[model samples]
Target: MATQAVTNPVPVADLRRRPGRSASLRRIARKKPVGAIAAVICLLLILIAISADLLAPQGANQIDPLKNPRLLSPSLSHPFGTDNLFRDVFTRIVIGSRISLGVGFTAVFIGTVIGASLGIVSGYFRGKTDLVVSRAMEVVLGFPPLVLAIFILAIFNTSKGYSFRSFLLLSFAIGVIIAPTTARIVRGSALSIRNLQYVEAAESIGNTSFGIMRRHVLPNVVAPIIVIASIQIGNAILAEAALSFLGLGISDAYHPSWGTMLQEGRPVWLEAWWMSVIPGTAIAFAVLSFNLFGDALRDVLDPRLRQSS
Candidate 1:
């Protein structure tokens, strides 16, 4: 009688030692160095955003009474220095990350999910629906995104001051600004998906149009969606910051936004450079990291780009 062979269990440690995240990361680094760097930066940003309370040295709004604390400048004691209120700039920035990332991600999610669904329907049925959707997208595209956002925020009665509800409203406004572009991109990608054999098979199998779009069309077009989403997260962040700067957004004293920081600093900037420079640098870093990661993701994800490379 032949005995069944007993298999030896591999340790989880051994599995890790063999090839996995590290190997994939190394391959990514080798194939796309800039992308890898950008990925690291984005990761760091996320980590900081997540651990803000733990990492911050002081309360976001705690006004330190330390001698001449106002705009003390960056040093060992205060990395980002103090603001005019003697509040910790570093702490405020850290806390502010919660707001910025929350808005950016939420807005992008709203925009992408809504836009992708609309786009799939528009592209899958290319008659009157397509014509109407495409024209509507064009009309939305015709407006300046920032201006549209400002208008929407105003219409939503954001004058009630920046509360949790108001922040959500601001996010919705920004999401609307983002939706048209995402719709256009997803629409273009969905168009090609219609000709795929699987799509035909799905239809032949009596799969509902929605099912076909959800299962086949959506998955096929995900690469572009991912790249667009990454890029748009950064845009959403910038929009939040810009609106905040314009006094049309976040202004709660307890909350510290880079845009609001900039607004506060604008008057006293000459007297205290860190007030402007530090928050400005933070904004730049976030936007640049996102843009770089998005560009790198596009290069890596796009089938045409992958083939060319």
Candidate 2:
């Protein structure tokens, strides 16, 4: 008599989800305290960017050297004080959030698309394809990020500066800089999935490579990609700031980027500290928020990290 073998069954509601991989916001907040704070800071930044026009008391570039005292220290009238041009420093900082965060988000999106495509294809195919891609990524990593960014920007001749087109050009340059790092991380994760039993089973069943990658490999790599993409956004923000500081990125006249603010404050920093300090602080907080959120996300989502947690 062939006896039917029985085994313990998971609850239907639980399904295939692992114990620590809760997708609930409450769970995230309870499990990771720092992540909650980062999430709040990031949310505030986005809200400020979105509502810059309404929130800012004055226009970002509304200058009145005679009406408003230049380089006035932080006061009731000007919370962040005034720049040399007597423009409201608070207004510029508020407006700059839009440009800074815009560049960061856009650059990460571009990097993710390019890096994930290369990594999944290379990791799944292996052999010559893997070798070629690995070498190319290594070559890209060899160049200094700022140098590579400058080289790419030169191609566009963005000396004209601060238009919507220039904004995209800057984002694309930073995206290219971050793509190799993203590819390296993604490829490692994909390689692990490629050797899994289910993937081999799919291959044995004569599934197409693209089908296998999409159905099996891509889904598995998504967690790592999310973590990587968030961290890349922080890097992109810093990169854009650096370029703007060098007068190579967004124009201060059109868009008052934190980096441009720093450049403006450099000469007057000795006497007017508010100009540099305020914008520099903004950049630090923005980067820290994203990076901390990325770390927290990785701890929650990555199985290895979750085990340690």
Estimate every model's Cα lDDT from 0 to 1: 0.86, 0.89
- lDDT value for candidate 2? 0.89
TM-score of each: 0.90, 0.90
> How well is each residue in 91-135 modelled by candidate 1, as lDDT tens digits?
889988878878888899999987888788888998999999989
Point out where model 1 deviates above 4 Å.
1-21
- Residue 188, model 1: lDDT of 86
lDDT of model 1, residue 222: 89
The residue-by-residue lDDT of candidate 2 on 84-115, one tens digit each, is: 99899999999999989999999999989889
Error of 2 at 211 (Å): 2.0
Report residue 71 deviation for candidate 2 (angstroms).
Answer: 0.9
Which candidate wins on lDDT? Answer: 2
